[model samples]
Target chain A: MQDVKAHALLINEVGLHARPSVKLTQLAKRFAATIEIAIAADGPWTDAKSPVKIMRVKAAKGETLYMRANGTDAEEALRALADLVNRKFDEE
Target chain B: MGEQKNVGIVIVSHSAKVAEGAADMVRQMVGDSVPLAAVGGNADGGLGTDVGAIMGAIDKAWSESGVAILVDLGGAETNSEMAVEMMPEERRERIVICNAPLVEGAVMAATEASGGSPLDAVRATAEELMAN
Candidate 1:
């Protein structure tokens, strides 16, 4: 089977603030899939379910984050996560 | 309260720093007896389904009375729901999700109600969310 793929960018003015990160972290934890994400250009690798790691990304405008979810409910998680990154969680 | 139960707390953040930071803050206010578990989105360069971490925290809370999980934004939001979904019908009632602020609301409720059993603390945390 092919790996499920998803991606998101930090577009919020502040970019990945505490509140948004918290909300997103909880969402990702609901599934039974392996999720990993990283800044397309630069930064360290990290799990999607962690705010401390995600916040450390220091994503500015135009920074792209590549995400992949594999296992059960991967597609659902991918879609919502993609939307979250794109929607900027209404922070935009 | 039927019994003084110890509730488990899970703090999820977009990164480890945030979860750690929240954990640190909450640790200070609450007494040492209460069990607290914290997980972040910074594991292995990706973020998704931290089943181990989430389960560990939940288990800690459930050891005695039951467990209540709290999460921040990002993956934590979805993860909380997932944890609840995995529970058996009987156990499902014991797990509580605090959609409110992980750092503030959940911490406050957890600390204040820590005296009661895990179920009491979990209920208190949920009630706080509903009220707020």
Candidate 2:
């Protein structure tokens, strides 16, 4: 499977706070793919499946979160993650 | 998902408000998917750690999967240890006192647990925050 990539804006009011981080990690764990997220396009990424790591990203509102996934379900993982973020993590 | 059980979490702090506040954070972040309990203050309701209260909190948050405890300050940790020691041998084996910050660790641990992660994984997720 080829690596899949996507990006979504952190439009939530509080950005990637604890609640959003937990939602993102929980969603990431559901996929068989390995997902990594970064604040910038080419840079240090953190495991999307780890809440603590993702929370450390501290991506604020208006920041874009770049994600890459590699595995059989990579595409699906990226799509779902992007959708979740675009939906404002279902928070609003 | 209805039958699935997640690892439980217990928060131990010197202040009652702190423990409850941390538990509230966990609930807000992870929802009610994981068992959670908070215990703090002495018998007189002043600032202190109580082993009895800690033990009760452990019981309240008990899960078949296991329970991970997050404590604040040395007194809380020491009392939590005593509470663990006072438990049955089998129960003792399933409880762990995580060395991590109270609020952050509880939230992270509960998040991991809410995903149906194992006790060790939940504890590790919480403890990992200390590194950051």
Candidate 3:
């Protein structure tokens, strides 16, 4: 299947800090999709399932974060991840 | 959730508060999904590590998936080593004392464990922070 892709603004106060990163990875792991995240739409994506890599993304507040996933659950994974970022990780 | 075992984690520090604090961070981030325990201070409640306490913490955090331990200082590492050594030979291989920053390592390890990752992956995730 073609990779599913999505992007959302990092509206949370701290962006991809420890808590949010943990939340993201935990959510990503629930799907069978092989997901990757990038600070920009062009390149340099990292594994969405690794909390450490997600934290290292360091995408600050107001930044746009891109995500893409491959696998049977790709579309669902992208939707959930986009929804998560849109909700500001439920931090606000 | 309890039906699926995740790698357990043990935090060791010279100060009880430090160990407890790290464990608290792990819980706050990962919730109780991963087995966790903290051990610190001497029997007298002084700032020192006790082998018995470490051993107990290991037992408390034990899982067939394995246990990854994080220590703060040299003494804490030494005591953790002794604690691991004292365990049954068969069970010893399942436990590892990670050489990573205590609080960060515990948090990372617990996060990985919460995902039902194996002990090596959990330990690797925790240790990877040291390179940053």
Cα lDDT of model 1 by residue, A1-92, tens digit: 56687677777776665545544654675567877677763335566765444544566666677777788789998888878878876665
Across A15-63, the per-residue lDDT of candidate 3 in tens digits comes to 9999999999989988988999998888798999988888888889999
Task: Give the TM-score, chain B only, in order for the candidates.
Answer: 0.75, 0.96, 0.96
DockQ for candidate 2, C-alpha atoms: 0.86
Clashing pairs in 2: none
Stronger candidate by lDDT (1 vs 3) = 3
In candidate 2, what are the lDDT values of residues B15-95, reduced to their tens digit? 999999988888888898888999989999999999999999999999988899999999999999999999989999999
lDDT of 1 at B121: 43
lDDT (tens digit, per residue) of candidate 2 on A1-92:
77789999989899998788899999998888999999999969899999989988899999999999999999999999999999999999
Tell me the whole-model lDDT of each prediction, alpha carbons only.
0.63, 0.91, 0.91
lDDT of 1 by residue, B2-114 (tens): 33366666676667777778788766644455677677664484554465567666765563466666676666767777767776677777777765677776555455345
Least well predicted 10-residue stretch by lDDT in candidate 1 chain B? B123-132
User: Candidate 3, what DockQ?
Assistant: 0.81
lDDT by residue (tens digit), candidate 3, B52-75: 999999999999999999999899
How much is the lDDT of residue A47 in candidate 2? Answer: 96
